[model samples]
Target: MTVERTLHHFPLDPASRQVRLALGEKRVAFHEVAERYWERRPELTRLNPSGMTPVLVETDGGKTLVVCESRAILEHLEEVTPEPELMGRDLAERAETRRLLQWFDRKFDYEVNGLLLHEKMEKRLLGLGAPDPANMRAGREALRAHLGYVEKLLTERDWLNGRRLSLADFAAAANFSVIDYFGDVPWTDFPAARTWYTKIKSRPCFRPLLTDRWPGLAPVAHYDDLDF
Candidate 1:
């Protein structure tokens, strides 16, 4: 049976970007519906009561499956399309992958994104006035700390989780990509993390994300540059 898949997501959303990277890496074809989740469109809310972006709707003939949120959508994709095996093959690898996923989704998000993204991107999108200077400073400091951790991890391993590329890499990349869009990432201060990002940025799965653009939010000149 052929499954018709549709992804309703916000282009600049980190969570949405994770799912997009996963789908692209897994080679799954799907239609996209760019949503303004803050407005809480009735159709979006009907699909997900929380009215979040990154909702996946898959229809196989008459049967339809609605997977809400990035985590759920990613897990669902892994189950249905297991060839690429993004989560991991072994227990240790899987555990590490899940751990890093949580780290990025929660810790990194709260510390870095909550300040930087909320001020730079969210405030602009919602017309909530200018970015807060104090918050931006704090966010930059936190980002450097996180990047230092990433640099340490890369020093001991090929990928974020282990030797092989996993969801952990995608998770971190997704978050950093959004931050890089605003030119806030201190790439020069972390050479290892920058090199790692360059590797992921050159991947075929990352192409779409490189082209992502929103009104009044222009990416840095090096945002899409693989060598930068």
Candidate 2:
């Protein structure tokens, strides 16, 4: 018998959620093991020496196939499942999509996620001191600049870089939700991004994400409403 494929991840993590959303999008059923990412879980560290959430464990021939890192997991899924086509199938299209995915992951991580989420969610989740006004302000400023860059991308084409929606959109939205925690995005400033985000957020896979909450930080009221 082929042993099952399972994913161990923290529920609130965007990178982890990106994989979850991919699983949902592809309609791939896998066991979900909620891993404690903030605290150092021994099992998690044992399974993944890097101590990262979003580890994919595939059991085959009585051996555990361990894969760590978000990008690697994504590619592995594309190779093994090959359905619903998160990464484009063709050689050129796949390479281009990977480029855009990296752009979304790297650019968004540096410019938006660390800038905004480091201030708002990280402090709260890590049980550190209260929010830093300076950090919060910095995040807002950085997010606005990044949003403008997103606008530039939107102006050039419909999705991030191609005719169809790719992992780039999911990657971008995953980061945006972190910033949106602080109500940082001025939706009015970028209509194209706003419109595209609204549509993506309205998807069934995205709905559960809207309901996610930290102890003191529930989502903004409009997050779950889907029309906001």
Candidate 3:
């Protein structure tokens, strides 16, 4: 018996991207509904009263479950599909993975994506004027600090949490992918971070994202390049 699964997501959203990556890695079959969440659509609110993106809906045996928010969706996926575990093997590693996931989702997002994506991409999508130069400058500056922290972590461990690739890597890479789409990431200046990202970019799950094209805006030339 086949189940029906659907993911409502915003293409460039980092959290949304995380869910997509998790689904792809788990090899779960799902179709996507691209929602401009900023518009506050009725369909979005019906699934999640708060109207957040990356909502996952699963239907099986006449039962329907709606999972809202990226974190919950991720945990639900892990619970339903335990093989090829992405959280981690041990307690400590799982804790660390959650820690880094929070770091990127909350702290890094506030300092970087809030300024960069919201000021530029979000604004443009909403028919707002050009991005604020001040915001862009601040975003770039904060990005340096975040990338430096990631570089330090990579230097000590193979993956963000430890030896194995875990949810932490997907969380961090998801955020970086959005910035990379705009050519905002200066890879040359951050060699270690670049190398780490290259490994993630080569995965089969990442191919769909590489082909993502925003209406009037194209990604950077090397956005799809694995050797980049």
lDDT of residue 202 for candidate 2: 81
Clashes of each: 0, 0, 0
TM-score of each: 0.99, 0.90, 0.98
* Backbone clash pairs in model 3 (N, Cα, C under 3 Å; residues 3+ apart or in different chains), count: 0
Model 1 Cα RMSD, 1 decimal: 0.7
Ranked by lDDT from best down, the candidates are 1, 3, 2
Give the residue spans of candidate 1 off by over 4 A: none
Model 3, 163-212: lDDT tens per residue?
A: 99988999999999999999998888888889999999998888889988
Worst lDDT window (10 residues) for model 2? Answer: 218-227
Best-first order by TM-score? 1, 3, 2
- On TM-score, the leading prediction is 1
Residue pairs with backbone overlap in model 2: none
Q: Model 2: per-residue lDDT, tens digit, 175-226?
A: 7775665577788888988988988888777865776766677776666666
Report lDDT per candidate: 0.94, 0.77, 0.92
Backbone-clash count (model 2) = 0
lDDT string, candidate 1, 56-81, tens digits: 99999999999999889888888999
